[model samples]
Target: MPCGGGESLEGDAAIYRQLLSISGHRPKVVLICARATELPCEEIAAALLALGAGKVETLTLGARTDGEKPAFLETVENADAVLLLARQPLRLSTLLGGTSLARLLRRRNAEGMPVAGSAAGAALLAEHMLAGGESGPTPRMGGVMLAPGLGLSNRIVIDQGGLLGDRLGRLLAALALNPFALGLGLDADTAAFIGPDNVLEVIGSGALTIVDPADIGHSNIADAAHNAPISMLNLRMHVLVHGARYDLDFRRPLG
Candidate 1:
Protein backbone atom coordinates (compact mmCIF):
# COMPACT_ATOMS: atom_id res chain seq x y z
CA MET A 1 0.00 0.00 0.00
CA PRO A 2 1.29 3.48 -0.85
CA CYS A 3 0.78 6.42 1.52
CA GLY A 4 1.01 9.83 -0.10
CA GLY A 5 2.44 12.05 2.69
CA GLY A 6 0.35 15.15 2.15
CA GLU A 7 -2.78 16.19 0.30
CA SER A 8 -0.75 18.05 -2.29
CA LEU A 9 -1.61 17.09 -5.84
CA GLU A 10 2.02 16.56 -6.78
CA GLY A 11 2.73 14.44 -3.70
CA ASP A 12 -0.32 12.21 -4.26
CA ALA A 13 0.57 11.75 -7.91
CA ALA A 14 4.09 10.70 -7.07
CA ILE A 15 2.87 8.18 -4.51
CA TYR A 16 0.36 6.83 -7.00
CA ARG A 17 3.18 6.10 -9.43
CA GLN A 18 5.15 4.35 -6.68
CA LEU A 19 2.04 2.35 -5.77
CA LEU A 20 1.51 1.31 -9.38
CA SER A 21 5.04 -0.08 -9.45
CA ILE A 22 4.62 -1.80 -6.09
CA SER A 23 1.41 -3.51 -7.14
CA GLY A 24 2.89 -4.64 -10.45
CA HIS A 25 0.88 -2.16 -12.55
CA ARG A 26 -2.46 -3.99 -12.47
CA PRO A 27 -3.95 -2.76 -9.20
CA LYS A 28 -7.39 -2.37 -7.77
CA VAL A 29 -7.54 0.81 -5.70
CA VAL A 30 -10.44 0.79 -3.22
CA LEU A 31 -11.63 4.14 -1.91
CA ILE A 32 -13.76 3.73 1.23
CA CYS A 33 -15.57 6.63 2.85
CA ALA A 34 -18.96 7.86 4.03
CA ARG A 35 -18.79 11.30 2.46
CA ALA A 36 -17.61 10.14 -0.91
CA THR A 37 -19.80 12.71 -2.53
CA GLU A 38 -17.99 15.54 -0.81
CA LEU A 39 -14.43 14.47 -1.58
CA PRO A 40 -12.46 15.15 -4.73
CA CYS A 41 -12.44 11.55 -5.89
CA GLU A 42 -12.39 12.42 -9.55
CA GLU A 43 -9.09 14.18 -9.06
CA ILE A 44 -7.80 11.18 -7.11
CA ALA A 45 -8.87 8.83 -9.88
CA ALA A 46 -7.11 10.89 -12.49
CA ALA A 47 -3.97 10.91 -10.38
CA LEU A 48 -4.07 7.14 -10.12
CA LEU A 49 -4.53 6.83 -13.83
CA ALA A 50 -1.47 8.96 -14.36
CA LEU A 51 0.41 6.76 -11.88
CA GLY A 52 -0.42 3.65 -13.92
CA ALA A 53 -3.23 2.11 -11.93
CA GLY A 54 -5.19 -0.21 -14.23
CA LYS A 55 -8.42 0.71 -12.52
CA VAL A 56 -9.70 2.92 -9.70
CA GLU A 57 -12.95 2.30 -7.89
CA THR A 58 -14.77 3.91 -5.00
CA LEU A 59 -17.13 2.10 -2.66
CA THR A 60 -19.61 3.93 -0.47
CA LEU A 61 -20.16 1.95 2.72
CA GLY A 62 -22.53 4.51 4.19
CA ALA A 63 -25.19 4.13 1.53
CA ARG A 64 -25.87 0.48 2.18
CA THR A 65 -28.91 -0.75 4.07
CA ASP A 66 -29.73 -3.97 5.97
CA GLY A 67 -31.43 -5.57 3.02
CA GLU A 68 -28.76 -4.79 0.45
CA LYS A 69 -25.81 -7.10 -0.08
CA PRO A 70 -22.31 -5.83 0.45
CA ALA A 71 -19.67 -5.63 -2.24
CA PHE A 72 -17.85 -8.90 -2.81
CA LEU A 73 -14.38 -9.43 -1.38
CA GLU A 74 -13.43 -11.07 -4.65
CA THR A 75 -13.57 -7.60 -6.14
CA VAL A 76 -10.73 -6.60 -3.83
CA GLU A 77 -8.89 -9.93 -4.22
CA ASN A 78 -8.39 -9.26 -7.90
CA ALA A 79 -6.74 -5.91 -7.18
CA ASP A 80 -3.15 -5.34 -6.16
CA ALA A 81 -4.08 -3.56 -2.96
CA VAL A 82 -6.70 -1.41 -1.21
CA LEU A 83 -6.54 2.28 -0.33
CA LEU A 84 -8.90 3.42 2.44
CA LEU A 85 -9.73 7.11 2.48
CA ALA A 86 -9.55 8.99 5.76
CA ARG A 87 -12.91 9.20 7.61
CA GLN A 88 -14.20 5.94 6.17
CA PRO A 89 -16.06 3.99 8.84
CA LEU A 90 -14.76 0.47 9.55
CA ARG A 91 -16.76 -1.70 11.93
CA LEU A 92 -17.07 -5.45 12.58
CA SER A 93 -19.19 -7.95 14.57
CA THR A 94 -19.63 -11.70 15.21
CA LEU A 95 -23.10 -12.61 13.86
CA LEU A 96 -22.44 -10.72 10.63
CA GLY A 97 -19.91 -8.32 9.20
CA GLY A 98 -21.63 -5.02 9.97
CA THR A 99 -20.17 -2.86 7.22
CA SER A 100 -18.69 -3.31 3.78
CA LEU A 101 -15.50 -1.85 5.20
CA ALA A 102 -15.40 -4.53 7.87
CA ARG A 103 -16.03 -7.33 5.41
CA LEU A 104 -13.33 -6.06 3.09
CA LEU A 105 -10.84 -5.92 5.95
CA ARG A 106 -11.63 -9.48 7.00
CA ARG A 107 -11.18 -10.66 3.42
CA ARG A 108 -7.84 -8.92 3.04
CA ASN A 109 -6.57 -10.46 6.27
CA ALA A 110 -7.68 -13.89 5.19
CA GLU A 111 -5.80 -13.52 1.89
CA GLY A 112 -2.84 -11.55 3.31
CA MET A 113 -3.24 -8.69 0.88
CA PRO A 114 -1.49 -5.41 1.58
CA VAL A 115 -3.85 -2.80 3.14
CA ALA A 116 -3.45 0.86 3.99
CA GLY A 117 -5.62 3.46 5.78
CA SER A 118 -5.42 7.20 6.37
CA ALA A 119 -6.69 8.82 9.59
CA ALA A 120 -9.92 7.00 10.52
CA GLY A 121 -8.94 4.57 7.83
CA ALA A 122 -5.74 3.84 9.77
CA ALA A 123 -7.58 3.56 13.07
CA LEU A 124 -9.75 0.72 11.78
CA LEU A 125 -6.64 -1.23 10.80
CA ALA A 126 -5.69 -1.62 14.44
CA GLU A 127 -6.26 -4.73 16.57
CA HIS A 128 -8.66 -2.64 18.67
CA MET A 129 -10.16 0.72 17.76
CA LEU A 130 -11.85 3.60 19.60
CA ALA A 131 -15.32 3.48 18.14
CA GLY A 132 -16.77 7.00 17.68
CA GLY A 133 -20.50 7.77 17.64
CA GLU A 134 -23.36 9.54 19.39
CA SER A 135 -23.32 8.81 23.08
CA GLY A 136 -22.68 10.36 26.45
CA PRO A 137 -19.21 11.26 27.75
CA THR A 138 -18.24 7.59 27.52
CA PRO A 139 -17.59 6.29 23.98
CA ARG A 140 -18.31 2.61 23.30
CA MET A 141 -15.53 0.40 21.95
CA GLY A 142 -15.88 -2.84 19.96
CA GLY A 143 -14.13 -4.43 16.97
CA VAL A 144 -11.98 -7.40 15.96
CA MET A 145 -9.09 -6.85 18.38
CA LEU A 146 -7.22 -9.90 17.04
CA ALA A 147 -8.28 -9.49 13.43
CA PRO A 148 -5.35 -10.08 11.09
CA GLY A 149 -5.14 -6.85 9.09
CA LEU A 150 -3.16 -6.53 5.87
CA GLY A 151 -0.29 -7.01 8.30
CA LEU A 152 1.34 -3.77 7.14
CA SER A 153 2.18 -3.10 10.80
CA ASN A 154 0.95 -3.89 14.29
CA ARG A 155 1.14 -0.47 15.89
CA ILE A 156 -2.18 0.95 17.12
CA VAL A 157 -3.24 4.09 15.21
CA ILE A 158 -5.08 7.14 16.53
CA ASP A 159 -6.51 9.83 14.30
CA GLN A 160 -6.01 13.33 15.63
CA GLY A 161 -6.37 17.02 14.69
CA GLY A 162 -9.48 17.00 12.51
CA LEU A 163 -12.41 14.85 13.61
CA LEU A 164 -10.59 13.63 16.67
CA GLY A 165 -10.30 16.78 18.72
CA ASP A 166 -7.78 16.65 21.59
CA ARG A 167 -7.78 12.86 21.23
CA LEU A 168 -4.26 12.26 22.49
CA GLY A 169 -5.22 12.55 26.18
CA ARG A 170 -8.10 10.14 25.69
CA LEU A 171 -5.88 7.72 23.80
CA LEU A 172 -3.27 7.80 26.52
CA ALA A 173 -5.96 7.23 29.11
CA ALA A 174 -7.25 4.28 27.12
CA LEU A 175 -3.73 2.89 26.91
CA ALA A 176 -3.49 3.20 30.67
CA LEU A 177 -6.64 1.16 30.93
CA ASN A 178 -5.16 -1.47 28.62
CA PRO A 179 -1.35 -1.32 28.64
CA PHE A 180 -0.30 -3.63 25.85
CA ALA A 181 0.04 -1.54 22.70
CA LEU A 182 1.98 1.37 21.25
CA GLY A 183 -0.02 4.47 20.19
CA LEU A 184 0.49 6.37 16.92
CA GLY A 185 -1.28 9.69 16.41
CA LEU A 186 -1.40 10.70 12.74
CA ASP A 187 -2.07 14.34 12.10
CA ALA A 188 -4.11 15.55 9.17
CA ASP A 189 -2.45 14.90 5.80
CA THR A 190 0.23 12.85 7.56
CA ALA A 191 0.88 9.11 7.16
CA ALA A 192 3.44 6.52 8.21
CA PHE A 193 3.77 3.83 5.56
CA ILE A 194 4.58 0.82 7.75
CA GLY A 195 6.28 -2.12 6.03
CA PRO A 196 6.23 -5.79 6.98
CA ASP A 197 9.59 -5.35 8.68
CA ASN A 198 7.90 -2.96 11.15
CA VAL A 199 9.72 0.01 9.63
CA LEU A 200 7.55 3.15 9.79
CA GLU A 201 8.46 5.56 7.01
CA VAL A 202 6.98 9.01 7.01
CA ILE A 203 5.40 9.69 3.65
CA GLY A 204 3.14 12.73 3.87
CA SER A 205 4.05 16.33 4.59
CA GLY A 206 2.64 16.31 8.17
CA ALA A 207 3.78 14.51 11.31
CA LEU A 208 3.28 11.07 12.84
CA THR A 209 3.06 11.28 16.64
CA ILE A 210 4.03 8.23 18.67
CA VAL A 211 3.13 7.65 22.32
CA ASP A 212 5.05 4.84 24.05
CA PRO A 213 4.20 4.41 27.74
CA ALA A 214 6.69 1.80 28.85
CA ASP A 215 8.42 4.13 31.32
CA ILE A 216 5.48 6.04 32.77
CA GLY A 217 6.06 6.52 36.46
CA HIS A 218 2.44 6.47 37.53
CA SER A 219 -1.05 6.47 36.05
CA ASN A 220 -4.19 7.54 37.93
CA ILE A 221 -6.76 5.44 36.13
CA ALA A 222 -7.63 3.51 39.29
CA ASP A 223 -9.99 6.09 40.70
CA ALA A 224 -10.46 8.34 37.67
CA ALA A 225 -14.05 8.59 36.58
CA HIS A 226 -15.14 8.36 32.97
CA ASN A 227 -14.02 11.36 30.90
CA ALA A 228 -12.17 12.75 33.93
CA PRO A 229 -8.80 14.38 33.50
CA ILE A 230 -5.88 12.01 34.08
CA SER A 231 -2.96 12.88 36.38
CA MET A 232 0.47 11.77 37.60
CA LEU A 233 1.38 10.23 34.27
CA ASN A 234 4.78 10.17 32.61
CA LEU A 235 4.98 9.45 28.90
CA ARG A 236 7.40 9.87 26.00
CA MET A 237 6.49 10.63 22.40
CA HIS A 238 8.39 10.99 19.11
CA VAL A 239 7.31 13.00 16.11
CA LEU A 240 8.33 11.45 12.82
CA VAL A 241 8.45 14.33 10.46
CA HIS A 242 8.03 13.85 6.75
CA GLY A 243 10.75 11.77 5.03
CA ALA A 244 11.99 10.22 8.28
CA ARG A 245 11.81 6.50 9.04
CA TYR A 246 11.66 4.39 12.23
CA ASP A 247 11.82 0.66 12.68
CA LEU A 248 9.03 -1.02 14.68
CA ASP A 249 10.50 -4.52 13.95
CA PHE A 250 11.54 -4.49 17.58
CA ARG A 251 9.14 -2.86 20.07
CA ARG A 252 11.32 -0.06 21.40
CA PRO A 253 11.65 3.71 21.19
CA LEU A 254 12.18 5.01 17.67
CA GLY A 255 15.89 5.79 17.55
Candidate 2:
Protein backbone atom coordinates (compact mmCIF):
# COMPACT_ATOMS: atom_id res chain seq x y z
CA MET A 1 0.00 0.00 0.00
CA PRO A 2 1.92 3.00 -1.29
CA CYS A 3 -0.47 5.81 -0.32
CA GLY A 4 -2.71 4.69 2.50
CA GLY A 5 -3.06 8.02 4.22
CA GLY A 6 -6.01 9.45 6.18
CA GLU A 7 -8.33 9.77 3.19
CA SER A 8 -6.60 6.57 2.01
CA LEU A 9 -7.93 3.38 3.62
CA GLU A 10 -11.45 3.91 2.33
CA GLY A 11 -10.18 3.44 -1.18
CA ASP A 12 -9.01 -0.06 -0.32
CA ALA A 13 -12.04 -0.87 1.81
CA ALA A 14 -12.43 -4.35 0.43
CA ILE A 15 -8.96 -5.47 1.37
CA TYR A 16 -9.13 -3.75 4.76
CA ARG A 17 -12.40 -5.40 5.56
CA GLN A 18 -11.14 -8.76 4.44
CA LEU A 19 -8.01 -8.49 6.54
CA LEU A 20 -10.02 -7.59 9.63
CA SER A 21 -12.49 -10.36 8.87
CA ILE A 22 -9.77 -12.92 9.46
CA SER A 23 -10.46 -12.67 13.20
CA GLY A 24 -13.90 -14.21 12.69
CA HIS A 25 -15.95 -11.16 13.78
CA ARG A 26 -14.03 -8.06 14.73
CA PRO A 27 -10.24 -8.25 14.77
CA LYS A 28 -7.45 -6.66 16.75
CA VAL A 29 -5.57 -4.34 14.42
CA VAL A 30 -2.26 -2.87 15.48
CA LEU A 31 -0.90 0.24 13.81
CA ILE A 32 2.84 0.29 14.39
CA CYS A 33 3.99 3.87 13.78
CA ALA A 34 7.47 3.24 15.16
CA ARG A 35 8.84 4.15 11.74
CA ALA A 36 7.42 7.66 11.89
CA THR A 37 5.17 8.92 14.64
CA GLU A 38 4.02 11.85 12.55
CA LEU A 39 1.70 9.60 10.58
CA PRO A 40 -2.03 10.19 11.18
CA CYS A 41 -2.69 7.46 13.73
CA GLU A 42 -6.08 8.72 14.79
CA GLU A 43 -7.37 8.92 11.25
CA ILE A 44 -5.93 5.54 10.26
CA ALA A 45 -7.21 3.85 13.41
CA ALA A 46 -10.62 5.35 12.88
CA ALA A 47 -10.68 3.92 9.39
CA LEU A 48 -9.67 0.49 10.68
CA LEU A 49 -12.34 0.64 13.32
CA ALA A 50 -14.83 1.56 10.68
CA LEU A 51 -13.61 -1.40 8.70
CA GLY A 52 -14.49 -3.66 11.67
CA ALA A 53 -11.26 -3.89 13.61
CA GLY A 54 -12.27 -4.93 17.13
CA LYS A 55 -9.46 -3.05 18.81
CA VAL A 56 -6.88 -0.68 17.38
CA GLU A 57 -3.75 -0.08 19.47
CA THR A 58 -1.03 2.13 18.05
CA LEU A 59 2.46 1.33 19.38
CA THR A 60 5.33 3.67 18.67
CA LEU A 61 8.79 2.09 18.76
CA GLY A 62 10.73 4.59 20.86
CA ALA A 63 7.79 5.94 22.77
CA ARG A 64 5.97 4.71 25.90
CA THR A 65 7.01 1.07 25.71
CA ASP A 66 10.49 1.28 24.29
CA GLY A 67 11.80 -1.20 26.83
CA GLU A 68 8.67 -3.31 27.00
CA LYS A 69 9.72 -5.99 24.54
CA PRO A 70 7.41 -8.67 25.80
CA ALA A 71 4.36 -6.38 25.74
CA PHE A 72 5.16 -5.22 22.23
CA LEU A 73 5.74 -8.74 20.96
CA GLU A 74 2.63 -9.97 22.74
CA THR A 75 0.45 -7.26 21.24
CA VAL A 76 1.67 -8.07 17.75
CA GLU A 77 1.29 -11.79 18.33
CA ASN A 78 -2.26 -11.43 19.57
CA ALA A 79 -3.39 -9.09 16.86
CA ASP A 80 -5.34 -10.38 13.89
CA ALA A 81 -3.86 -7.82 11.49
CA VAL A 82 -0.88 -5.50 11.78
CA LEU A 83 -0.18 -2.38 9.70
CA LEU A 84 3.11 -0.51 9.68
CA LEU A 85 2.74 3.20 8.96
CA ALA A 86 4.50 5.26 6.29
CA ARG A 87 7.54 7.56 6.13
CA GLN A 88 11.32 7.32 6.69
CA PRO A 89 11.81 3.62 5.93
CA LEU A 90 15.46 3.77 6.92
CA ARG A 91 14.60 4.91 10.43
CA LEU A 92 11.88 2.29 10.65
CA SER A 93 14.32 -0.44 9.64
CA THR A 94 16.87 0.81 12.15
CA LEU A 95 14.35 1.01 14.99
CA LEU A 96 12.68 -2.33 14.33
CA GLY A 97 15.99 -4.04 13.57
CA GLY A 98 16.94 -3.74 17.26
CA THR A 99 13.64 -5.15 18.44
CA SER A 100 11.84 -8.46 18.07
CA LEU A 101 8.84 -6.65 16.56
CA ALA A 102 10.24 -6.79 13.06
CA ARG A 103 11.10 -10.45 13.38
CA LEU A 104 7.65 -11.12 14.81
CA LEU A 105 6.12 -9.48 11.74
CA ARG A 106 7.98 -11.92 9.50
CA ARG A 107 6.93 -14.86 11.65
CA ARG A 108 3.32 -13.70 11.76
CA ASN A 109 3.15 -13.38 8.02
CA ALA A 110 4.56 -16.86 7.68
CA GLU A 111 1.76 -18.09 9.92
CA GLY A 112 -0.92 -16.49 7.69
CA MET A 113 -1.47 -13.21 9.60
CA PRO A 114 -2.24 -10.12 7.53
CA VAL A 115 0.79 -7.90 7.94
CA ALA A 116 0.49 -4.71 5.90
CA GLY A 117 2.11 -1.31 5.24
CA SER A 118 1.74 1.92 3.28
CA ALA A 119 4.15 4.23 1.41
CA ALA A 120 7.63 4.01 2.95
CA GLY A 121 6.25 1.30 5.18
CA ALA A 122 5.62 -0.70 2.04
CA ALA A 123 9.23 -0.29 0.87
CA LEU A 124 10.73 -1.74 4.06
CA LEU A 125 8.79 -4.95 3.57
CA ALA A 126 11.27 -6.02 0.90
CA GLU A 127 14.47 -7.91 1.60
CA HIS A 128 16.47 -5.20 -0.17
CA MET A 129 15.06 -2.03 1.29
CA LEU A 130 15.19 1.20 -0.75
CA ALA A 131 16.10 3.62 2.03
CA GLY A 132 15.62 6.80 -0.02
CA GLY A 133 17.58 8.90 -2.53
CA GLU A 134 17.60 11.37 -5.36
CA SER A 135 14.91 10.99 -8.00
CA GLY A 136 14.69 12.26 -11.56
CA PRO A 137 13.16 11.40 -14.90
CA THR A 138 16.39 9.81 -16.09
CA PRO A 139 18.45 7.04 -14.59
CA ARG A 140 21.62 8.12 -12.79
CA MET A 141 24.41 6.42 -10.93
CA GLY A 142 24.34 6.61 -7.13
CA GLY A 143 20.75 7.81 -7.13
CA VAL A 144 19.59 5.33 -4.47
CA MET A 145 20.78 3.53 -1.36
CA LEU A 146 20.10 -0.15 -0.75
CA ALA A 147 19.89 -1.71 2.71
CA PRO A 148 18.74 -4.98 4.23
CA GLY A 149 15.08 -4.88 5.14
CA LEU A 150 12.71 -6.95 7.30
CA GLY A 151 12.95 -9.75 4.70
CA LEU A 152 9.20 -10.07 4.34
CA SER A 153 9.62 -10.62 0.60
CA ASN A 154 12.85 -11.23 -1.23
CA ARG A 155 11.38 -11.23 -4.72
CA ILE A 156 11.11 -7.46 -5.32
CA VAL A 157 12.70 -4.10 -4.52
CA ILE A 158 9.67 -2.11 -3.33
CA ASP A 159 9.88 1.54 -4.32
CA GLN A 160 7.65 4.45 -3.45
CA GLY A 161 6.38 7.32 -5.68
CA GLY A 162 6.61 5.43 -8.96
CA LEU A 163 5.92 7.26 -12.28
CA LEU A 164 3.93 9.99 -10.59
CA GLY A 165 6.78 11.19 -8.37
CA ASP A 166 9.71 10.75 -10.79
CA ARG A 167 11.47 8.07 -8.68
CA LEU A 168 11.55 5.44 -11.38
CA GLY A 169 15.03 6.62 -12.29
CA ARG A 170 16.30 5.72 -8.83
CA LEU A 171 14.64 2.33 -9.11
CA LEU A 172 16.34 1.78 -12.47
CA ALA A 173 19.63 2.72 -10.95
CA ALA A 174 18.98 0.38 -8.01
CA LEU A 175 18.17 -2.55 -10.30
CA ALA A 176 21.35 -1.88 -12.24
CA LEU A 177 23.37 -2.17 -9.04
CA ASN A 178 21.42 -5.19 -7.81
CA PRO A 179 20.57 -6.83 -11.09
CA PHE A 180 19.42 -9.90 -9.23
CA ALA A 181 16.48 -7.90 -7.83
CA LEU A 182 13.16 -6.88 -9.37
CA GLY A 183 11.97 -3.26 -9.08
CA LEU A 184 8.36 -2.99 -7.96
CA GLY A 185 7.59 0.70 -8.47
CA LEU A 186 4.37 1.76 -6.80
CA ASP A 187 2.69 5.02 -7.71
CA ALA A 188 0.74 6.98 -5.10
CA ASP A 189 -2.41 5.22 -3.92
CA THR A 190 -1.46 1.97 -5.61
CA ALA A 191 -0.41 -1.26 -3.89
CA ALA A 192 1.08 -4.63 -4.77
CA PHE A 193 -0.70 -7.16 -2.54
CA ILE A 194 1.63 -10.17 -2.64
CA GLY A 195 -0.36 -13.19 -1.54
CA PRO A 196 0.70 -16.46 0.09
CA ASP A 197 1.21 -18.09 -3.31
CA ASN A 198 3.72 -15.41 -4.40
CA VAL A 199 1.18 -13.84 -6.75
CA LEU A 200 1.17 -10.04 -6.60
CA GLU A 201 -2.31 -8.62 -7.03
CA VAL A 202 -2.40 -4.98 -7.99
CA ILE A 203 -4.71 -2.77 -5.92
CA GLY A 204 -5.73 0.90 -5.66
CA SER A 205 -6.34 3.37 -8.51
CA GLY A 206 -2.74 3.74 -9.72
CA ALA A 207 -0.44 1.35 -11.57
CA LEU A 208 2.56 -0.81 -10.64
CA THR A 209 5.79 -0.80 -12.66
CA ILE A 210 7.89 -3.96 -12.85
CA VAL A 211 11.52 -3.48 -13.83
CA ASP A 212 13.25 -6.73 -14.68
CA PRO A 213 17.02 -6.70 -15.15
CA ALA A 214 17.43 -10.41 -15.74
CA ASP A 215 18.44 -9.86 -19.38
CA ILE A 216 20.81 -6.94 -18.91
CA GLY A 217 23.45 -7.08 -21.60
CA HIS A 218 25.20 -3.76 -20.87
CA SER A 219 25.47 -0.88 -18.40
CA ASN A 220 27.71 2.00 -17.24
CA ILE A 221 26.69 1.84 -13.55
CA ALA A 222 30.09 0.26 -12.87
CA ASP A 223 31.57 3.75 -13.13
CA ALA A 224 29.65 4.75 -9.98
CA ALA A 225 29.85 8.34 -11.07
CA HIS A 226 27.97 10.64 -8.73
CA ASN A 227 24.81 12.06 -10.38
CA ALA A 228 25.98 10.81 -13.75
CA PRO A 229 23.31 9.64 -16.14
CA ILE A 230 23.31 5.83 -16.32
CA SER A 231 23.08 3.70 -19.43
CA MET A 232 21.66 0.22 -19.38
CA LEU A 233 20.29 -2.16 -21.99
CA ASN A 234 17.67 -4.92 -22.05
CA LEU A 235 16.03 -4.20 -18.67
CA ARG A 236 12.42 -5.36 -19.01
CA MET A 237 9.67 -2.93 -17.98
CA HIS A 238 6.05 -3.82 -17.31
CA VAL A 239 3.26 -1.41 -16.29
CA LEU A 240 0.41 -3.23 -14.65
CA VAL A 241 -3.00 -1.73 -14.02
CA HIS A 242 -5.48 -2.43 -11.24
CA GLY A 243 -6.59 -6.06 -10.85
CA ALA A 244 -3.64 -7.39 -12.84
CA ARG A 245 -1.78 -10.28 -11.22
CA TYR A 246 1.86 -11.24 -11.68
CA ASP A 247 3.50 -14.48 -10.69
CA LEU A 248 6.50 -13.38 -8.63
CA ASP A 249 7.91 -16.91 -8.50
CA PHE A 250 7.95 -17.17 -12.31
CA ARG A 251 8.51 -13.44 -12.89
CA ARG A 252 5.75 -13.08 -15.48
CA PRO A 253 2.26 -11.68 -15.86
CA LEU A 254 -0.66 -14.03 -15.44
CA GLY A 255 -3.09 -14.48 -18.28
Residue-level lDDT tens digits of model 2 in 151-255: 887778888754535787888878888889888887766767777898888876777889999899979887757889989898888999878999888889997
Which consecutive 10 residues in model 1 have the weakest lDDT in total?
135-144
Off by over 4 Å in 1: 1-11, 14-18, 35-37, 62-71, 86-104, 107-112, 132-154, 163-165, 253-255
Error of 1 at 23 (Å): 2.0
lDDT by residue (tens digit), candidate 1, 1-255: 324224576755545555566566567776655544344667777777777778888655544452134343555656676766654334322211354545656566456566766445566566555444322223223211223333233456454434233556556655665566676766656666666567777765566777777667776667666556555356777877867777664655454
Among these predictions, the greatest TM-score belongs to 2
Clash count, candidate 1: 3
Stretches of candidate 2 above 4 Å error? 1-9, 12-15, 21-24, 63-68, 162-165
